[model samples]
Target: MQWIEIVVLALIQGLTEFLPVSSSAHLLLVPLFTDWPDQGLAFDIAVHFGSLLAVIFYFRDDLIKLTRAWVGSIVGSGMNQEARLGWAIIWATVPVGIAGLLAKGIIETSMRSGYFMGYSLIMFGLLLGYADWRYQRKFSANPASANSDEYHLSKTQIAVIGFSQALALIPGTSRSGITITAALLMGVNREASARFSFLLSIPVIVLATMLQSVELVAEPLPVGWGKLLAATAISALSAYLCIRVFLALIRRIGMQPFVLYRLLLGAYLLYCFY
Candidate 1:
């Protein structure tokens, strides 16, 4: 890959990985539009690993606290809020993991069509907008309530969000977007919704990266080590910055901008593909 392709693909992966916009869709569309050859399995693994590293690094402190609390509760210590939150992430990840395993073949085959992705982008964009609007209404009526105990969630609520996250398997139904939409519909505050969505990403990315790594090892593709290293470093830096800025401004700006962007992108895809 040329330096330009490396930079563009890496930037797209890093920037869109956490955003409500679908990173998978962007990655799929880029080569199609640019007429570039596929970036191959090795490149895919590198960029995804970069994203995983970014999220883990950004939330290092929270992960430490959650890890200790979760382990403590498992050892018969009384469950506390942190422990519960930790358990929430674990339980919430199950549905998507199962869905991925069961639907992997279909998702990799039929669901990659541009038309399907276009419709998914529109459908989920509208859902995200509705959820965001609902959250704003609730926040307006009870401002103080929005900020109080943001991460506190009931088991049923976590399960609901977990199941909703499985929708992300579709080409354009972004993982972060779907999860955040479910959380918002459940009345989680913006910051909390985003935080949980991001935290929820850790395990999924790890699993995906591991699976791709195994595939790459089995096939043993000739990889450009220099390009792979550059992709990883560039993607990591961009992803970390994206996370920091997103968390900082999510409350102030809300999800409307992303929704609008998704809608426009979806429409364009539909027009082009059809």
Candidate 2:
């Protein structure tokens, strides 16, 4: 790949991976529009691994605390909030994992159509916008009433969000977007909803990378080693910065900005493909 293609695609993967804007949709559409050849699974794995590391690095402190608490609880130590949250994250990842396994063939074969991607982009965008508006209105009436504890997701909420995550298998139903939208519609605060959505990503990315790695074990090396390294570095840096900025931005603006972006992007894609 040319340097320009490397940079653009890597940046797109990094920037959209965490946001509710659907990284998969952007990745899919870019080559479609630009007439570039598919990046192939090897390069896809490399960039994804980069984004995975970015999320893990950014949340290192929280992961450490959650890990220690979770491990301690397993050993019969007193359970705490972080420990419970840790287990909740594990429980919540199950639905998506199962869905990925069961639907992998169908999703890969039939769900990559641009028409479906466009529809999901528009429909999910409107739903997300409505959820954000509803949340703001409901919270504004008694903004001072919520304590920090209310942000932590209940068991039922986690299950609901987990189930919703399976929708991400569709071409434009972004994993982060669907998960965050579900959390918000279910009454999670913006920051907490984003936090959980990102946390849920860790296991999913790891599983995906491992699965791809198995396929790559016998394949010829993809691209030059040097190019792969450069792409990985770019992916990591871009993704880390994207996560930081997105989290900070959501605190200030809620999800409306991203929702608007999705709406415009969907409409443009529909025009192009439909």
Candidate 3:
């Protein structure tokens, strides 16, 4: 990819990664529409790493507190709220990690193919819209006034959300979208679901990026390190800003706008590709 293409792709990756709009779908569709060369495994790994850094930086203090609390709990001290949250995140990551490992090849072969991109877009868009509708109805009927602590998810709920995340292997099924949908279905409030979803993403993204890096190292691409570094830097900066903006928007307008956007994007993809 040219430098300009790299910048555009990185920006797209950063923005969509946290925006509930499916970063994978945008990456695939943007390249298709723009006539850019496929950003192969190396580029993908770089972008993921960039977003990983963004999240880490954004939540540094919370992460430190959680880690310390978790360690203390392990040594027989009473766990604090942050420590319990840390444990919940750990529990929620398991299903996705295992599913990603087992289905890695299958997902790569099937969903990542350009042929399936349009289908994924339409299908997952409808699913997200349905989920949002259900969540809105339930919330309107009996609003949740409880805080995160009060609605702390059980292990079963975590497992279910984690398993739902596996569906996000498809290009249009945003990881946050699917997991938040699961959490909402399980009765967690929207903001709490979103918060936990963001926290849960740290480990999963880190491990997946590491695995992708290993694959890239096994067979170095034609691109040089300078290009990789530039791409990653741009992506990281963009992702950081994206996450901030998304969180603000969620607090203000809720997720309905995102649901509408997904549906329209999906329809556009179907029209263009099918």
Candidate 4:
């Protein structure tokens, strides 16, 4: 890939990965508008790995605490808030993992059309907007409780969010978007929901990267390592900044902007394709 393609794709991947906006939807538009060649599997893996790095690094401190607490509970130290949350993350990832394995082929083949993606973008955008609206209305009367604690979520709530994440297998549904929508629907506050969504991403990204790595190993495509490294660095820096800024501003801005953007983009796509 050219330097321009490398930079643009990397930045897009990083910026959209954690946002409610669908990164896959945005990336699909690249080749449609430009004459750029497909950003082969190697490059795809590199950028995602960079995103994985950003989330992991940003949550390093929390991960350390969670890891220790989780191990402690396993060895008979008993459960605490951190350990309990650790287990919740694990259980929450299971549904998406199974769904990906079972339905990935069908999703990639049947759901790659612009019409399908456009419909998904619009439909899910509305769902996200509704979820955000519900959250705001329920908490507007209680400003002090606007940032409710997520650790107190019931098992049913976690399972609902987890199962909802499987819907993200559709090209434009967006894993982060669906998970956040589910959390908001379950009455989680914006900040708490965003935090849990980001934490939940750690395992999901790892799983995606591993699956892609296996494919890359089997095909063994010739790749430009230098370009891949550059993509990784660019993606990592942008993703890290995105996480910091999003966490800082989500409580104030809410999800309306992203929802509106998705709607407009989806409409444009439908106009062009259907």
The whole-model lDDT of each prediction reads 0.90, 0.86, 0.78, 0.91
Off by over 4 Å in 4: 144-147
Tens digits of per-residue lDDT, candidate 1, 138-203, equal: 888989758633358987779988999889988999999999999998878888989999999999
Ranking by lDDT: 4, 1, 2, 3
Off by over 4 Å in 1: 148-150
TM values, all candidates: 0.97, 0.95, 0.91, 0.97
**Per-residue accuracy of model 2 over 62-104 as CA lDDT, tens digit each:** 9999999999999999888889889888888899889999999
For this target, which candidate reaches the highest lDDT against the unseen true structure? 4
By how many angstroms RMSD does model 2 differ from the true structure? 1.6
Q: How many pairs of residues collide in each model?
A: 0, 0, 0, 0
Worst 10 residues of 4 by lDDT: 143-152
Q: What is the lDDT of residue 132 in candidate 1?
A: 92
TM-score of 4: 0.97
User: Poorest 10 consecutive residues of model 2 by lDDT?
Assistant: 144-153
lDDT of 3 by residue, 1-274 (tens): 6888888888898888877778877776775567777778888888888888998898899899999999999998888888888898887788788888898888877777544666665666666667667767776776653333313677778778878888887777889888877876776766677778888889989888888777877884486678889888998999899877777666457677887787777777777666
Check candidate 1 and list the clashing pairs: none
Off by over 4 Å in 3: 113-115, 145-151, 221-223
- lDDT winner between 3 and 4, please give it: 4
